[model samples]
Target: MARGKPDLAALETRIGRDFADKALLRWALTHVSAAAQRPDSYERLEFLGDRVLGLAVAHMLFEAFPDDSEGELSRRLAALVRKETCAEVAELWGVGPYIRLGEGEAQTGGRKKRAILGDICEAIIGAAFLDGGAAAAEAIVRAAFGPKMHEAGRSLRDAKTALQEWAQARRLAPPRYRLASRSGPDHAPSFELAVEIEGFEPAVGAGSSKRAAEQAAAAAFMAREGVTE
Candidate 1:
């Protein structure tokens, strides 16, 4: 069963934001499965938070990389605002314990789910925005993502996109992915996929999701081919 009310005060301290209206924070942490109504879930907040994160990250990139071209800035923005980055931020904030998941989702390890973590991260940003405006949202985003933004040698392109571009530059056909195998239970399945490029051996990767497996395969292929960003 879902737990009683989570300690939002501790969550606020961790994320470095205090909500004027605590209900928004509660709503932000609420998963759809635990919500009495779908609208009461974090979905709406997530949508708004996604936009807020993009704008905040874009602005930060503009100021931080004065010498970077528009394309470079765009790539950096993409990296910062990606779901993976958001999920990392959520993990850093220790948000999992506070998420309100239904019994089934809780049992299935929904707290550790990448998608859920990322969505709740954005939802928290949305709540911050609603409670204290853009400044509040940007503050939280900066505190969490700012250090990562300045990290040198970070690959802006996701592995799949990077691999595709690598193949195109070499006049090779686009890489193709095939599902090699799937294992585990329905709630926590693992996927194995192979990515093949012309004139090269296929690289295999495994992950909890097909897209992740595909990206892993692409990264593996690049590694084997001595490709680097």
Candidate 2:
């Protein structure tokens, strides 16, 4: 029913590491929801991968852009290691297909879920780390998320992207930007938009257009959250 071992060899090739203990690589893609139905679970691997991934991404961020300030580096780190980004990597690696899911999770599109995919990606990294070492794990994570650090660094001023990524990672809808107050009109339109992050307080921003106001609010939110750029 699973059909030919989910082509872990392909995944291993993508990871650029040949697994001596094939079980480890397989386990990395397992999820608790799927484990409940099957016997293997990725929870432990996820735990290990979490640290492995954090360190690798952190190191890459540190070395990639030498002139970056601490705050700017931190923001880049967050952009790469964030759940949304990991999920993107997981999807790229086809980790979701190998995941064993329970009835409900599988039925409800568990494989496509960002949180679940992100967790599996982390687990896979942990598995690589355990099977090999920091270097091995770092190689894998760097391959997957390395470009993102560069892109995020370049888009530091683009707060809208930041806000969208942040909101999506939390599994919430995008932030709603509303004009809380407006002054002047026609010749000179000023807007005060309340950019509300779901489950968090709203940050107000002002700009010439609605989109500009939203971007302003997102920037304000990032600043308040101690995110640079």
lDDT of each: 0.88, 0.75
Best by lDDT: 1
lDDT of 2 by residue, 1-229 (tens): 2656467787788767898788898787766655644346887888889888888887988888889999887777666775667778888887767777666667667777766787788888888888888998888888888877656334543587777777787698888887798775332346789888767888988865465577679889888877553
**What is residue 120's positional error in candidate 1, in angstroms?**
1.3
* Candidate 2 Cα deviation (angstroms), residue 203: 12
Q: Which tens-of-lDDT digit does each residue in 1-229 have in candidate 1? A: 2357567778899999878898999899998878998899999999999999999998888888899999988888888887778899999999998888888778888899987898899999999999999999999988999999877877798888889988899899999999999987654567999999879999999876787789889989988989986
How many collisions between residues are there in candidate 2? 2
Q: Pairing residues by index, what is the TM-score of model 2?
A: 0.65
The clash count of every prediction, one per candidate, is 0, 2
At residue 221, give the lDDT of candidate 1.
91
What is the alpha-carbon RMSD of candidate 1 to the true structure?
A: 3.1
